[model samples]
Target: WQVFRFAAPALMAGNAALLKHASNVCGSALEIEAVFREAGFPKDLFRVLLIESGEVAALIARPEIRAVTLTGSNRAGESVGAAAGKALKKTVLELGGSDPYVILADADVEHAVQVTVQSRLTNSGQSCIAAKRFIVVPEVREAFERGVVERMKLASCGDPMLESTQVGPLARLDLREGLHRQVRESVAAGARLILGGEIPSGPGAFYPPTVLSEVKPGMPAYDEEIFGPVAAIIPVKDEEAAIAVANDTSFGLGAAVFTRDLARGEKIAKERIEAGSCFVNALVKSDPRLPFGGIKESGYGREL
Candidate 1:
C-alpha cells in the first residue's frame, strides 16, 4: 500500500521510482518491482534497491534521486529527512502513530468495542494507523472495557497462513519483547492489566492480545506507541475530557469517534479530533480515493 500510494502518482507524472524497502522485506520489495514490470511499466521505471541503511545517505545524495518518501519509524524518518534536507530534495514521511479511539457517553457500547478491538488488532497491531488508545467517557467506560476484553480474548493467535488465525506473531522477536516490556512497565506504573499480558512460549514471535486499563500519562501504554496487539483503555470524565485526552498525544495520524447520535459523532470527528483523518462510527483507515498521511511527529505531507 505504501509503495503503490506513492509509485502510482510518480509513474503518472513520468517520474521513476527507486524503492529502498525495509531490510527484512527485500523479497516483497522485489515482488513489487516485478509487479510493475509485469504490468508493462518500463524495466527500470520502478527499481528496488536492496541496500543497507548506512548506504541511504549516499543514495539520497545522488543527483538522479529526485524526491524521497518513506513509511517507517520516527528514527528512520529523522535520518532520511536529515539526508534529504542536506541534498535539498523534496521528501514525504509517514511515521509511527498511537491513534486514539474516542467512545462517547451515548455510544453503542457493543458496536464501539467491536470496532475498537478489530482496529487495534489489525495487522497484529503493526499498522501505524491501528487504533492504540481507547478514550471512553465515564458513562460507558465500564461496559466498554468489559466488551473490549471479551472481544479481544476471542482473537486466537496462530499461523498467519491459516484463515482461522485472527491474530498472528509480530514481524520480529524484538518487537514482541519491546511490547511485553511496555506492558510490564505500564502495569508496574499502575495501569490495570485486565487481560492477556503474557508472552506465550511458542516458536514464532507471538504476543497475546493484552488489555491495560487506567492507563495514564506517565505509563508507557499512554506515552509510547505499543507496536503490537495491546489495547490501552483511558477513562475520561465527559465529552470535553475525552477530546482532551484524545488530542493530548504527539501523534496526529488517525482517530475515530463512536456515538449513537450521527450529528454528534460527525461533529466530534470533524471539529474536535486532531488528526489527519478522523472517522465517525468506524475504524480510521486509508482509502484510494481519500487523502492519507499525518501531522506532527507522525510526519507531514499526504499519501493515498
Candidate 2:
C-alpha cells in the first residue's frame, strides 16, 4: 500500500520509481516490481534495489534521484532526512506514531471496545496509525477495559498464512523482545497488566494480545510506541482531561474520538484532537482520495 501510494502518482506523472525497500520485505518488493511489469507498464519503469542502509546516502546524493521519501522509524527518518537535505532534494517522511483513541461517557461501550481492539490488533499492531493510547472517561473506563480485554483475549494468534489467524508474529525476534521489554518496563512503572503480557513459549516471534491499564505519563506504555499487539488503557477524569491525554504525546499521526452524539464527536475530532487524520467513530485509515501524513515528530508531507 505504501509503495503503490507514491508509485502510482509518480508513474502517472512520467517519472521512474526506484524502490529501496526494507531488507525484511525484499520478497514483497520484488513482487511489486513484477506486478508493475505484468500490468503491461514499460519495463524498467519500476525497479527494486536490494541495498544496505549505509548505501542510501550515496544514492540520494546522485543527481538522477530527484526526491526522497521514507516510511520507517524516527531514527531512520532522521538519517534519511539529513542526507536528503545535504543533497538539496525534496523529501517526504511518514514515520512513527502513537495514535490515541478518545472514548467519551456517551459512547457505546461495546462498539468502542470492538473498534479499539480491531484497530490495536490490525497488522498485529505494527501500523503507524494503530490505536496505541486509549483515553477513556471515568464513566466508561471500567466497562471499556473489561470489554477490550475480553475481545482481545478472543483473538487467535498463529501463523500468518492461516486464514483463521487473527494475530501473527512480529516481523523479527528483536522487535518482539523490544515490545516485551516495553510491557515489562511499563508494568514496573505502575501500569496494571490486565491481560496477556508474557512472551509465549513458541517457535515464532509471537507475543500475546496484552492490555495495560492505569497507564500514566511516565510509563513506557504511555511515553513510547509499542509496535505489537499490546493495548494501553489510560483513564482520564473528564472530556477535557481525555483530550489533553490524547494530545500529550509528541506524535500527531492519527486519532479517533467515540461519542453517541455525532456533532460532539465531529467537534472534538475537528478541534480538540491533534492529529493529521482524525476519525469521529471509525478507525484511522488511509484512502487514495484523501491526503495521508503526520505532524510533529511523526514526520511531514502527505503521501496520497
Model 1 / residue 277 / CA error / Å:
0.9
User: Model 2 residue 41 lDDT?
Assistant: 95
Tens digit per residue, CA lDDT, model 1, 1-96: 789999998899989999999988999999999999999997799999988999999999999988999999999999999999999999899999
How many backbone clashes does every candidate have?
0, 0
178-234: candidate 2 lDDT, tens digit per residue: 999999999999999999999989699999999999999999999999899999999
Best by lDDT: 2
Q: Per-candidate TM vs. native? A: 0.98, 0.99
Candidate 2 has which clashing residue pairs, if any? none
Residue runs of model 2 more than 4 Å from their true location after superposition: none
Best by TM-score: 2
